[model samples]
Structures are given as structure tokens and as C-alpha cells.
Target: MMFGQTPVTHVGVDPFNPPNPDVWPATMAPVQQILREGLDLGPVTVFVGENGSGKSTLVEGIAMAYGVNSEGGSTGAMHHSRTTESDLHSGLKLTRNPGSSKYGYFLRAETMHGFFTYLADNPSMGRPDSDYHGMSHGESFLELILNRFRGGGLWILDEPESALSFSGCLSLLSVLTQLVDGGDSQVILSTHSPMLASLPGADIYEVGPWGLRPNVWEDLELVRNWRSFMDAPQRFLKYI
Candidate 1:
């Protein structure tokens, strides 16, 4: 079967030690309610929202629920973690087909470097040249995505555009679009980049004060505003 459509049949937190109650974004309550409704059947799914709107929190919750690592495999620089082991979220329920896999990869911003290092050391994945390996942050970002993401499995990426230049984001988009077209891999990404959100057939869900809701990247008011402002910065800047 194709990815994403394999309906998620259960949701739960680690019982021994759970996520912190304090770190749960005020927006999470509703988002959790909606996720409990149903999983998207589309090929590529995306979550977009403001910085603190709980997009990552919800994504991590989904990963934990599915038994995927919170870090998504690659480990590099450690950033401040919001959820402690003792933290917890309840009221989760299952609603679909059940299955399990041996491989699931979660990619976060800081882990990109580590991902590449592992790839370089492991020839089975792909062997990128030193120039590609040592390229700027954006180049390395593209290289890792191209090399590491080449199979049928569950992949979750949070804020992938952090290191990518606009062109690099476009490159990642091309790769993802092609991967989805192949009909084997499934990916859920949390990002704010319009370029990334605009991938064809991507189910874009916005998480914010109102919680998660079906959305179109082009319909986001912020996208339009940013496009307009960037189009004529001098025009908008004079007012400021």
C-alpha cells in the first residue's frame, strides 16, 4: 500500500515517563482533538504554523505515538528540548489500519550535519563527493535529503528549510515531489517555508492559535503578505 493512507490506528504517549504538561502549547489541546479525528489519505502531508504554535509538538507526538524516534534517526547538535520524560498527554485514541516497520527516520534542523556524517561513513546509503559534503549549509542540506531519503518508509522532518537557501529548498521540493510520485515513501513535515509548503499534492495543515486545520499554502495570508512586501519592499518600508 502507499504511505500516509495506511490509516493510523492508535495514539498514546510513553507511559513510564510522559511529556511535560507545562510545555504543551495552549494550542495543542484542539490540535490533538483534530488529529484524533482521522489521518490524511494523501501522499505528502505538511504542517505549517507560526514558531510557537505547537507544530513540532504535535509532530513529535505523532512520531512518539507511532513508535518512531523523537529525533528521527540523525543526531547532531542538541537544542533545548521542551518536553521532559515526565511530561504527558492523554485522551489519545486510535482509528485505522495497524502496521509497523523496522525503519523510520525523523530529521530535525540541527541533526542535518550528523545525518550527512553518517551517510558519508555508511556507503550503503550514497557516497557524495567531498565538495558536496563540504558545501555551504544549504548545499549539505540538499545533499543529505537526496541521499538519505530513498526508500519506502515513514519520514518526518521538522523545519527542514532552516539550513536551505531558497534554491536549496526548491531542490528539496523537486526531490520530494519525485519521491511522492514514485508511490512508496510517505513524509510528514513541519515547516514555514512557502516553497516547501507549495509541493504538489501536499496536504498542508496549519497549526496555530486555532489549532490544526486543513489549509492551502497559497491561501495563507502571511504568504500573500510576504510576497507583496518582498515584491516592493521600498513601498512598504516607507510607512515604517
Candidate 2:
């Protein structure tokens, strides 16, 4: 079942006048090449890969193309410490279902500190329960999702597992389940956590040197490696 009333139907690099390959970031090359054929999206689309695989780059581009802040937060939460954004968004295109997005947010683990700082500076934007700085990273993340994320919106998260424990991951899973199942919301996440990637009915796409490809949760390299490590920590530890 599709989650959002306005789930993204298609996304790809704009064909007419694409960025020059030489000027594009190396990380984005895979997606840029793959997007030639156009990529279809579902209610929940996930991008997964090892570090530097361009998962974040792809998701960030999508978020920017959708008009959300490149660092993190909603479109209105604009603040930039230093611009490191790639030009991929300019070359990307998104097609959503008929209805307009009610709301949107982009959360990147690495930039939440800066985002919170921005919010702190702009006290008017503060939430009633705004004490994110005092809470643990995982707690703050959960709080953001639970409070800021109203249903019937678009949420793009990058490496949320960075701050989450296993239990926190499960909590996020539950929250996401509620968001997708109970409301009209669409989520696109970039993560390495097998637990998060295993969201029931989510479409997992593996971004790598070869490009984007649909992958089964269990068959993913990250999942297999994590499972192997859990099965025998001592065996893998010998290598270290």
C-alpha cells in the first residue's frame, strides 16, 4: 500500500541539459548515469550503500530538488555555515502524485547540531518541547520525528542510525511504520542499518559504483555482513 497522498512517482536527472560529467561530483556519477532511464519511486524509497557510495548525495539531491534545506530541516529552516552542497539538484527532477506536499523535512545526522543551533538562534521557530541540545542524540532524533513530523508530509533522512542504538532503531521503525501505515506520508531514507532497511514493504535501492539496483533486505551486503558479525564476533575480531 502506498503511504503518501503525494508520493513521488518518478525521479531522475533532468535529461534536456544535464550537468557536465567532469563537473559533477564523483559520488553522483552512478546516479547520474542510471537516471538516464529515469527512476520510479514508491511510498517509501530507501537508498543504501557503504560510506562514500553516494547514498547521501543522492538523497540530498532529492531533498534539495524538493526545496528542503540542503543541510537539514524544512525549506523554511534556512541557515548555512558553509556551503558544501553539490550541484546535482539542478540536474535532477521529481514528479509527485497530484496532491501537493502538506509539509516536508530533511534530517541529516551529521548536520543536526548545526540545524539545532539555527533553531536556537531563531527562538521563534522553537518547539514547545525544544531542548534537543540537552537530550542524547538518539533521543533528540526520536523527538524530532515524533514531534516535528506531522503525518501527510515528506521526510528525507540521511544516516539516522548514526545516533541510534538497536532499541532506538526499533523505536524509529515503529514510528515509521505508524507514519506510513496510519497517515499519508512519504519517506526516503539513506541508511546503512539493516534493521532500518528491513522496514516492511519499503523499496530498498543499493547505490554503488555500478549504480542503483533494487535489493532484498536479507541479500544486501550490509545485512549479510552484520549477520555474520553477530553470529561470531570472536571470529571476525581475529582479523582486527
Candidate 3:
């Protein structure tokens, strides 16, 4: 019931560390500071930010600090983006609660489903009743939430719901709620999906050109704008 103990605190990062010429984008903005500074939570957290914000970088750093595979569970090898290591420095430090056990898992939007499939099928990985390959992408996504994700672990997911249809997203939300209610698992996710961001009690950290900060779902202009248009689609359609 107590879940392990240790909670993540400090983490190593070069926040906006100057990018090396070999990587291009000569000088991307660095994070400069830990976004989660002084912030503590019961179990779940979400990282919500725009493209190119350093969310991925920070997550990767945290993954390394906690000994989670950037690729995913059981598979430590990862084909990370060159941008991630362009100007990589190891000096970044990661601090966590002494009682908490650290575990990290990242699911990039592009290969979220595929990654899950690979893990679900791997013999060494924990076996699941559902066949990952046979399921539709959305179903497989749900399977990850229902079968693979066990509470009490630190999971880093990047755009995990891209593969899920709206219904699938709802299914994931349900599973996430169960995890948090159990007070055993902690999640750090990067996603554009409003449904995923809407999780109750979730700490939404929006990473952007400015930096990471606590945010509400409404603060995401895209969501509000889309909803506004949907309320009266005909009005916006006239322009097109």
C-alpha cells in the first residue's frame, strides 16, 4: 500500500545547453532549471508543452538518472534523436526522494504503438493475455495501460495516446485514473491530446520557448480554439 518510497527530486540536464554544430539548430533554448522544482505530488504528473520545448530532453535525462530505458521496458538500447545528444553533457544532476524507487519508460508518438507491440511480444518481457500484434493500434494502446502499466512505477510516456482513437483515449484515461487512485504509480507524460491532459489531480507542466510551468488544460490555446470552432463549425467553414 505504501508504494516503494523514493520520489524523484533533482535531475541532471544542460537545459538549453548550446547545441553542437554537428546537430544543427546551433542554439536551441535550454531548460536552465528543473521544472518540477519544489513540486511534489501523490502519484501522477503530466508534461504538457509545445514542440521543440525541452520536454523530451528533460524526460530522457530523468530516465537516465532513474535507470529506465529510453527505448522502453527491458530494452535499454534506444535510437534517440540526434537533437537529443547534439550538445549532450553529463553534468546534469537528478535528485529524488530517498524512499521512492525510480523507474522510467518513454513512448514517442511516432512509434508508441510499435514500441508497445515489441515489448508485449518479447519473450523476456512480462507476458500478457492480449496479443499485441493482432490488436488495432488503439486497442494495443489500451492494452499497454491495462496490462503492462502496473502502479508504483515511474513511467515516462511521450505522446502515448497518438495511436489511440478518441475512444481509446478514453480507455487510457480510465486506466490512468485507476492507477492514481491506487496511489502506487507515478507518471510523467508528454502529450498534445486534451483528453490525456484532462486527468484529474495531474500536474500539467507546459514546456515551451519560455520554460516549464504549471498549466491548466484551458491554457492550451489549441484546445480552446478547436472547441470554439466545433461549437459552431458553420461559422468557421464560411472562411474556407
Task: Identify the leading candidate in terms of TM-score.
Answer: 2
- What lDDT does candidate 3 reach at residue 175? 70
Q: lDDT of each prediction vs. the true structure?
A: 0.62, 0.82, 0.60
Q: List the residue pairs that clash in candidate 2.
A: none
lDDT of candidate 3 over 1-240, digit per residue (tens) = 233343564444435543243442223343454432323544566776677777666665556556665555522634433233322334344556665544445556565555655555554445454676787777766765676577456766767767888888888787767765665566677777888888877778777766557777788764786798889999899999
lDDT of 1 by residue, 1-240 (tens): 234433343444334544344454423654544543444445577888888777777666665555555554522322233444212233233333445333456777765565556555654436443444578888766666776677555567889889888888888888777666666556678887888888787778877776567877779755787899889999899998
| Root-mean-square deviation per candidate | 4.9, 1.9, 4.5
Instruction: List the candidate numbers ranked by TM-score, top first.
Output: 2, 3, 1
Residue 17 of model 3 has an lDDT of 43
What is the TM-score of candidate 2?
0.92
Clashes per prediction?
5, 0, 22
State TM-scores per candidate.
0.72, 0.92, 0.74
State the weakest 10-residue window (summed lDDT) of model 2: 25-34
Root-mean-square deviation of Cα positions for candidate 3 versus the true structure, in angstroms? 4.5
Clashes, model 2 = 0
C-alpha positional error of residue 75 in candidate 3 after TM-score superposition, expressed in Å: 7.7
Residue-level lDDT of model 2, residues 104-200, one tens digit each, is 7899999888887887777653534578898999998888788777767788999999989999999998888777775477889999999999887
